[model samples]
Target: LPASQQEHIFNAAWGGSHKTGQLICNACNQSFSTNVDEVFSLYTTAIMNAWSFKGQRHKSVPIIELDGDYVLEAGAKLRIKPEKPLFEEKNLPNGQIRTKISFNSKGEAKRWLNNGGAESWLGRSLTPEEREYLLSLIKESEPQRREPEPQEASTTLNLRNQYRSSAHTILKCLGFFLPDLVCSPLTQPIRQFARYDEGDWRLFAVEPEQFFSLGEEITNLLGLGVYHNSVEIYWSSSSRMIVGILTLLNRVKRAVIISNNYAGSDKILYVFEDTNLSKKPPTAILAEIDSSKFCQPLLGVQYFAQPTKMYEYFYNELVGLTSIYNPIDAMKAELIKSLEEVNKHHTTLEGSTIDQYQTLYLNFFIKLGKVLQVSVDSVKIDSKLQEYGFSRLRLELKGRNITDPEVESIIVQAFDSVLSDWTQNRL
Candidate 1:
């Protein structure tokens, strides 16, 4: 391919700064985008929107669909988007009809009413007096507020396409970073599989144990916080394979085999970018892989059954990482972190500090209530309970200058009790 026909190795949607280079041919790059990158982008964007990971192109939060008549916005705000007005009618004992209406917004209700919504429900044309009265009632009545439970957006992905896309990226990374080995005979299998879809090779693996352990080390070194995009390419001497790992928003992970029968010295190229655009630009790190430190077994093409395991493991990791799928645990972890921060800063919580802690506590409780299917109004710290549970924890901390080891114990106990109660409801 000529220079003009070359395309970016890293997807620009990932907000990587190193996208300027000519790494792959335009035809092959466009093919990957059409076949696999689009679906991969959609899958990652849902998580990115939920976690607020801003990309280069998608600077604004994209609206994502949730369960029922709700849609989740960028900042985790759930907005109801009912297709039609919901009404609940009851016969009062005084022979009067009591009606309640629900709409996505007050404006929607007005528009529906203006377009003869009320008359259709009444089964007759309304008089001027009745129409005016209904409008007045709608204006005066306070809108009922209900919190929608957070649910993970459902996504259908072609596993074969995902595997191919991952391998294609690895090949592009190789072309950009390790040009010498990219066109070698050993890499032909990967190239053919990624570009032409000519092989039934196991192109990728989703081994959480290997991914997380190495991911921690890479993130720590790069100072890329919780949500970031990363790609690592290295030659494994023990396995005699050139491997690549791709991570998006620090959540989606894939390990791709670039070449299994490589004859090269140890080489490492780690590229990463913080999804939060304000922090840093894309960076490339060079290092040598120590054979002793890298003992991960090579995943060769002979393992035909590994693809099924990879699919299962990928979804399992996704569910655990996304907060919507596991809000209770997410909230619990956040609450624990908040308490720990408070304990670390203040010797004895008082005044504004106490207020801050209470604010965090209340916010957590409100979310927990929604997850538990309990109304927000019922999420209160009742003093009648003797057990040191959610409600009792606040009372236990009141006016106490206790900032010792017992604080941790109390937190653990409170979380355990809450978990027990939550599990009782099968939440």
Candidate 2:
């Protein structure tokens, strides 16, 4: 064969087609001996265990750099600069250093930032005190794992609807789909680990409350642990490797993976466990793996440049080093942030008459007040708008009535614009 034809054949067989590859035997054309066959068999097993094609869909998105403070969607600014280290060296494991501060765009960030700037943060850091405070703010952020009840009746529930009672069923499903995973145990007696399901895996580990707060921007739920509404699962250490195998399994569309870490926080290894996805129904199973361990199905797994270290990076580099500078005198911060915001993209009165203007302006401030967690005194808000040069000058009524819907549209847009500015300044 000509060299070009040979090259074409090799690329077509190995590179273009993931289903097959050519192995060049160096020795004679005869079949392998027993010892060599054994070694090769194990090699093929390892290869089969690690082979994945889902990597083709891995799309990296931009990172929203939270350089310093956190700004809310309602234009509230939180200056986060920690006064001291959140955790001392003794508190962390020996030789475990905090991840360094840096910017990145990979994994779930693509989905989070897909709205351009709606669900992003300039910074995500918090002081130890702020971290505790935020824990209180979002009460369900960290849930304690509950003791597992007696192995209940397992169900044939799909990945989306499974619960604590269905954990064993999920494990069975995992084992059914990929039996080799259960056979090769990193730790013995696989019944001791807890399971989580994160649907539509993303890279960064944002708390459920914050991630969900983005509304439609974040479609799938991250980690649903043992606590019924919680996202973290605590199980015995022995079966931990099972979760890693679940991450390697094929992703189910529209389902979430449960985990302490955010979905897509790890580099996803696409095991081509089943390739004929369009033709075949999704893989399902029902068999008990271990009595002590629980399982939660994953929509998919997460990955970053460094998968294992993503949690550390988020905690230490993003949240630990930053403080929530909630000053007792936040009035000035609020006033200035809002003032600066209005100057850039101030709202104009689109309705005629003082009543229309007042209604629209009042509604905008009221919306803002809720986000800033402050009272919207109508008089004070009017005065503030006047100070920012928003004219209450009436216009002639020519178009449709300025209803609540119009006011809502105007206010939401203004809120996003002002908040975007406030957040940009903090960064």
lDDT of 2 by residue, 1-427 (tens): 1112111111111111221112212221112221111221211111122221112112221111233332211122232322321222333477665432111222222233343321223265445674455334333333334333222221122212212212222333333344443344432222222222223223222222111111121112322111011111112123222232221111111112223322222122211123212222222222222323324322223444454564464444222112111121133234434444543442443443334444555665565565456665677555544433333233322242333345434434443444454345421
What C-alpha lDDT values do all the predictions have? 0.62, 0.28
In candidate 2, position 224 carries an lDDT of 14
* Candidate 1 local lDDT, 102-217, one digit each (tens): 77777888898899888889899989998888788778878778766545566676766776777776676666656777778988887787778777645444332242244458
Could you tell me which 10 consecutive residues in candidate 2 have the lowest summed lDDT? 6-15
Model 1: worst 10 consecutive residues (lDDT sum): 377-386
lDDT, candidate 2, residue 18?
Answer: 22
- State in Å the error of residue 295, model 1: 8.5
Report the lDDT of model 1 for residue 369. Answer: 76
Candidate 1, residue 14: the lDDT equals 60
Q: Which stretches in model 1 have alpha-carbon errors above 4 Å?
A: 1-8, 13-18, 57-59, 86-102, 110-135, 142-155, 203-215, 221-223, 277-281, 292-311, 321-351, 354-427
